[model samples]
Each structure stands twice: as C-alpha cells, then as structure tokens.
Target: MTIKEFKLPDVGEGVAEGELVSWLVAPGDRVEEDQPVAEVETDKALVEVPSSYDGVVEELFAEEGQMVPVGDVIISFRVDEEGDGGGGATATDAEPADAQPDSPASDGSEPEPDAGEAGDDGADAEPDTPSGRTFAPPSARRLARELGVDVAAVDGSGPGGRVTEADVRAHAEGDAGSADADAADAPEPRPAPTPTDTGSDGRKSAVSKRDAGGSAASSATAAGGPEPAGRETTLATPATRKVARDRGVDLDDVPTDETRDGEAFVTADHVRAYADAVESAAEPTPEPGPTDDAPEPAPAGGAPETATASEATTASGDETVPYRGVRRTIGKQMERSKFTAPHVTHHDTAEVDSLVDAREDLKPTAEAEGVKLTYMPFVMKAIVAGLKRHPYLNSELREDDEEIVLKGDYNLGIAVATDAGLMVPVVESVDEKGLFELAEEVNDLAARARERKLKPAEMKGGTFTITNFGAIGGEYATPIINYPETAILGLGAIEERPVVRDGEVVPAPTLPLSLSIDHRVVDGAIAAEFANTVMEHLENPLLLLNE
Candidate 1:
C-alpha cells in the first residue's frame, strides 16, 4: 500500500495558516477524492478542504485546535496498488502501518505522558507521550496555564483525542482541588518556620501569627498548584469563547450559571448578562435629594411620562441579535466606507410625468418580450449612456502615493435589500446590455443574492452604485458611499407633486434623486453634472431608447 499525504492549501488571499475548525472524516474511514475532509477557518472566511486522494485514512497529522501552515501535512491515506496510486484508493485487509514514535495513535487513543512527575525533572520525560498529556487543545492549555491548573490532570471529552477549555476548568475546580488538598494533608517532611510578629499586648495573636508564617509558604504552594480562591469562573461555548476573546473579556473570570456535563458552557446571553452586571457595578449612582432643600413630591396619580432612551431601548420585549454573516459584513464595510470617504450629497426632484408616460408606452413591447419594464431599467440605461458620454464618472478612485487613479470599466452595483441584509451585487459591462437584458440580469442577480447563492466575485468590483430606496418609501437620503467607488445614487419614491410647466403650476409624478459622491475623488461640480445627467434621462425616458 502507498501513503498519500494531504497538505493544507491556501484558502484565501495571502493566508499562511488556518485553524482546523472541524474534521469530517477520521482514520480508518474511507474517503473519496474531492470529498470534504475538514473545515478550516482563515482570517477572512471558513472554507472546506477536500481530500486530494481517494483512500482509506492512514493518519490525521493535525489536531482540530491546531493552526496548520499552508503546504504542511494535515492527513494521510493508504491506497491500493492497482488504483494507479495517484489520487485514487481501494479497501485492503492489510494492518495499518506503525505510528511514528512521537505521533498519537490513529485509533483515537489518548497520548501518554512523557514519563515524568507533575513538576520538575524534565530530562526524565518519555518519548511516546499520550494525546491526553501532550496534545491538549490550544484553548485547553491556555485556560489551564492561566488558571494555574495542570492540563495533564484534565480529562478531555472531545472526539478523537481532543481537549476543550471546559475540561481544563472542571479539572481545576473539582478533581485538581481535591487532589491538591489530599496532597497537602499528606505527611511530608516539614520545613523550618520563620519568626512572626507579636501583638501590642506582647502576646502573639493566633490568627495573625498563623497568617504571617503561612504567607510565604502559601505563595510557594500556589506557584506549584491551583490559583488562590475567590477568582471568578467562566463557562462558554467555543463560539462564545471567540467572541469573548475578540471583545477582550477575560473568559476565566466571566460569571455563568449554566453547566454542561459538569463543565460550564456559557452562551451569548450569559456573556451579555455578565457585561451588563459589570457595567452596572462600575457606574456611580446619583446623590440623594437634599432634606433642607427637599424637593416637592410628585402630584397624586402622576409619574414620569417618558422613559430614558437607554431604558426604552432595553425594556422592550424585542430580542437583541448579534449580527453575523452578510449583515455583519455589510456593517463593517459600510463603517469603513463612511470613515474613509468624505461624502457630499446633492438632492433634487425630477418631474417624471413624461417618463411615466414613456414607460407606459413601452409596457406592451416589454411584456411581449417577457420582461417587466420598470423606471430603473430606463434610469440604468440613461446612466450607461451618460457614462459613455462623460467617461470620468464611470470609474474607481485610488489615492495611493499622492496620486489619484480613475479606472475606466463601468461595473455598476445595484443595492438589493434582502431579508438578511442589504446586498449590492455588481452588474458588469452595463453599457453593453440592452434594457431588457439588463432587467433580466438584474432580476436574476437580485434573486440569487437573496437566496445566498451569489458568488463572492459578483459582490465586488463596483464602480458606481444605485439604491432604489424609493420603492420602499423615502424622499431623499444621504446614502453612504460604497467604498473604492466615487459615488452612489439613491432613488426616492415617485409621488405626485406640484411642478412648474410653461410657467404654470400643475400636479406631476416627481422623483427625488439623492446623489452622494466622495469629495476626495469628485468635486461638487462633477457630482452635480452626474446627477443632472441621471435627471435628464429620467425626465426624458425616450432618450434611453433613442441612444
């Protein structure tokens, strides 16, 4: 049998190492080529690693909590001889190969300790240590060392020789404490005692003297054992642990009430509760009203009419959800875009009465062609035509080395509001597609995006963005600038409004357009020109078809 080693592959841009989040297959389990074997988390995203060879598993070289560098061996598999030994394998009755001297057994056996006492005598360690002693997961060892507990004393409950943080904490609080108490009570050789201070009455106080003598000894004992009492205990899930780490919360000190299998498993709710408690404890209360200058009591049947904003925000029955996935991504990106780009908004109302009539005129043709014509299609077409006429606006801005870069390609972004969040999917080569084709493509992209089936590439490389908040009811808004691009156009709701035609006021369908442009890239004059171009297109809808 031949062994094939599967190395970790680079999953994202410039990533060197990834944490093994989970493994789908195990040693002795048959797997096929291109089958998912493990899920790895890079700095950017979580990606699954497919097996490179079809074979019976020979060994798993990387542990779940371990960070495996790109191109490093992660797993190996044994394949049959006639399988061409490339990336294919077949079952065999042969015995597994001998494990490496320092490797843990593939049968999910705990690694034995490198023969030595709990402390001291490092040279007396053994060569083949069990997974339990030497292979404690990253979080487990970190918790153990931080809490002054020995990892070797903890029993791991994770599958396939894995140790979790809970195991370490449980061992510290339960077994380790009892074991240390028993060891202290044992009849060991006593050390010489130091002298103590006497009280003012010339008599040694029983408790004070005992404490004085034990202080130094206690320090030494603590160095060799668990931490001193009264430190807070924290229990949380792996995901919650990650959140705590990101928020700079000391997981060892987070107070929790829930326990899983005798170990604390803190949920997101527990962390928030702990945070609230801490905030409340730290905040100072206002001083009580003065008695001499006693304020008058409230009138009978009278109370405060309104609650404070904080109280109102917190008192509602609505649930608070921590943002994840696309929403979280949108929040971060929008924040970055807003902070980086100096946005300037220009708002104006366009008389869309003619445009409405023009859309009605083309409705029959659009319906016959299996397309639903909307004002957006004409607006998009007009924008494309204007971009062709004024090429500078259809570009991206790059301020690197004190020089500005304006890209030429027109990759327009259409912001589609989904149930999850607002997603802006790019429509490439917008100047090329006709109105019907643009409508079809836009519909397909928006539908696919809401379904979460849009590729990452589809969400990027936008030169300009349009958000039709008008469809939902908005007049004009200072829309946030989509970063790397100079501008975003907000389309407000079309409503009947007074318009001046031939020096006479009359009711007409008017559309409010709010254009936000990056001041760093485009000046106010340029922004006005772009907005005017869009307004011209909407004011004369037939211009799009004529162009």
Candidate 2:
C-alpha cells in the first residue's frame, strides 16, 4: 500500500486557511475521488472538501476545531493497487482505531432515517461513543454550545450516529438538565491525541510534550471519598484557557483529570470534550416562578445597578469571540479596501412611480408562471445598462502595472448578509439573462448563500457588487466596494414620499440610492452620471428593453 497525502485546497479566493469543521470520513473509510470527506470552514462559507484520490483512509493529519493553513496535508490515504476502494455503506462506518460509532440499536449500524417511519431513534437513541471524542457537524456542535447542551451526551439518530441540528434542538428542548451538570462543574484535563507533524496553526495542546491522560475512570472521583483537598484543581496552558473561554467554559470549575508536577493538568481538547458532555447530559431547564418581593437575578459577574452595559464590559465581563473565519476575512478585506481605495460615496433618490407600477403590473403575470418578482431583477438590469455606458464603474485598477482592467463579462455579485457573514454569490453574464431569469437566479443564489451551500466558484469573478441594505430598513448610506471591484451600488428603502414631479407636490414612491466608488478609478462626475442612468432605466422599465 502506498500512502498519499491530501492537502487542503484553496476553497475560496485569497482564503489563507480554514478551520477543520468536521471529518465526514473516518480513518479506514473507503473513499472515491471527488467524494466529500471533510467539511472545511473558510472565510467565505462552510465548504465540503472533496477527496482528490481514491483510497482507504490511512491517517487523519488534523483534528476537528483546528485551523489548518492552506496547502497543509489534512489527511493521508493508503492506495493499494489491488484493494477495493469502492465505498459501500460500511457496517462499521470506518471507526477510528480507538473510537466506535454510536449505535441506535443493539445492532452496530446507524438507524434508518426514513422520515415517514418512526423508529427507536428519537428518545432511545443515545450517544454510546466509548471513545472520548464525539463526531458531529460543526454547526450542530455550535448549536449545542448555545443551547448549553452537550453533543456527545445526545443520542444521535442521524446516519452513522451523526448528530444533526434537529438532535441538538431536541436535546435543548427535552432532557436539557441531567447528570451532565455534575460533570460540567467538574471538568478535567483531556488526554491529547497524538500530535501530527504537519504545519502548525499556532494553537497549544493541553497535553505537553510528555505523558498525557485518558480513561473512563479519570472522569469521576473514587466513590469512597470526596476529591483530595490537597490535590490541585486545574493547571492548563494559555491556549487551553483561551479555547475554554471561547466555549463559554470556566476552567476553575473544570476538574483536573491528569496530574503534572504534582498538579492537575488540563488541555484545550479537555475543555471542549467536557463542554460536549455538559451539553449532551443537559436536561430541559425548568422555568422559574416569580418571587414578587425578591430582586431580579444578577447576571454573571457583579455589576452595579447604575452602571451601563458598556461600563460592565469595561469591567472585565465580556465574552471574547475569536475572529478567524468569515468575520476575520471580512475585516482584512475591508481594511485593504478602505486604505487602498479612496472611497467617495454619491447619494441620490429617484421618484420611481412608473417603475413601481410596472412591477405591480408584472407581479400577477410572474406569479402565474410560478415565479416571484422582486425589485432586485429591475435593479440588476438597470445596473448592467449603466455598466455598459460608464465602463469605469465596472472596472478594476491594477496598481502594480498602472493599468485599468475592464471586464467584458457582467458577473454581478449580490451581497447577501447571512448569519455566517457577508457572502456575495455572483450571477454570471447578467446581461444575457432576462428579468424572470435574473430574478430566479438571484433568489436561488441568495437562498443557497444563506444556507452556506454556494460553491466557491459561484462567489468568484465579479465585475461589480450590489448591496440591498434597504431590505433591512435603511435609506441612502455609503457602502464599501468589494476589493478589486471599482464600485458598489447600495439600494435604500423604497417608500412613498411627497415628491415634486413636473413641479407637482403629489405623493410618489421614491427609491434611495447610494453609489460608492473607488475614487482612483471613478471620479464624482462619473459616479453621478452612472447613478442617473441607473435611475432612468428604473424609472422607465420600457427603456430597459432598448438595452
């Protein structure tokens, strides 16, 4: 058998690295080329990483929750010339060396997920993972943390005992408080898995370069006595502490499962494992009854009645969110855009009564064809026309070569704000598509973007960007240009306001527009002209037919 290493490919443009969210395939699993083996979270979205080779999993190079740099070997596969790599629904689901998949039934296979047929997967399914590690999606784990439920403690009813989002929600709603509380109050140092010799992410492992700890017996104290008073409570690395804090766990309450230098030692892995146990074992919390005479319960850390939340935050009582994924990526991009491009915003409003009437007239016709008509299609069509007229608005400046690049393709990126962050799913060749086609594509892409299903290529190769801030209720504000793109058009709320159309102050629907441009590429006059052209197309939808 020849071992071949599979490195993490760049999932998104300029994405330096990604967090290994979860391993869809375990060691010893048979996998095919292009089969999804891992879920990697890049700055843009949660992407399913496909394997580049057909082989049996040899060794997993990185663990979940680790931020691996791009081009780092994530997993190794053993490709035997004579070996059958045809992936079948394995009886074992390719369990790792020491870990076993959870069994919903006495039989060691996963429960059937037939939605129509109810099986023993709901209440009876419990996490029977004997190994310390648990296998669940990163999103499921995050939901568990927010619900204060432990994912490892929940019985997974999913395929191969995989915990699903529904499992976490069910765990949070039902059986939320259980024996897990005692374990959470008494977390311990976790035995570290064997460290990989791959590139480092600059995080510390709880297990130092020495003997570590692990065992079922280590989780609890001896039944005969209380924990030894003289024994140390917790000793951990800084990275472990930071990881624990990020997981909303307190290290002081965590039990020291392993002793180092006559003291209990803990690692970042331990804190995470303990958190899993805590949330999984959690049962439904009972609602509190009111005490009329009693004062309201104080939140975490003591705060004065007069102090504002900002004051309390300054008083060392705030949760620190590690900026590494999409948020971090957005920060870097925004910084580069702000500093590199001298941004000048032009705000304007157009009384779009005719446009509104045209959309209203087309609504029924579109609905009859089973399509929903939104203002976005009109806005996109207008923008494409404007781009053609003022090419500078849809271009990029190459400083290194001191040249401007005007793209022939009209790949319009629509900025969709999701829970993950701002994701721009591009609509390629917008000029070639009609209003209905554009509307369908825009809706589909936006839907998929929020669900984190948009492929890496769907977000790339954009000439200009559009951000519809009006959907969230704002009118006329400066918008940042997506880097490498010369301009971004922000649409504000469309509402009826008194307008002087033909010198008459009658009620008319007005649409607010904010055009932000890279001053280096487009001056104020060019931006204003582009905005006017867009408004003209919008006001007279018949004019769009001329394009």
lDDT against the true structure, per candidate, is: 0.59, 0.68
List residue ranges in candidate 1 displaced over 4 A. 1-320, 323-325
- Which candidate achieves the best TM-score against the true structure? 2
Quality of model 2 by C-alpha lDDT: 0.68
For candidate 1, lDDT tens digit of each residue in 1-547? 4666678876543446777766655444445677677767543344567887755555555545656789887776665444243221121222212211121222222122233321243321223325413445434544554454544445568886566887776766685445544222321111111111101123221111112232322333344522222223333334455455443344444555444323344555555555444433333344566654655453212323333544676788556685544345456667877999888899988888888998889889989998877877777877776666655666666666665656677778898876545667889888778888888889898888676455546766777889999899979999997776778888998899888889999999999988888887777888778778877988987777765
lDDT (Cα, 0-100) at 336 in candidate 1: 74
Across 1-547, the per-residue lDDT of candidate 2 in tens digits comes to 3456788988876778888876766443445677777888765577788898865555566656678899988876644343332212121122222231122122132232233322333322223344323557656654664454546667678877777989978876676355354234533322222222111232333321221232211333332212222322355543576676555555544555554333456667777766555443332333567655566554323334536765777788687587776677677889888899999999999889899999999999899987899999999999999999999998989999999998899999998988878888899999998888888899999999888788888988989999999999989888988988999999998998888868889888899999999999999999999999999999999998865
**Residue 506 shift from truth in candidate 2, angstroms:** 1.7
Q: Candidate 2 at residue 328, lDDT?
A: 71
Single out the weakest 10-residue window by summed lDDT for candidate 2: 98-107
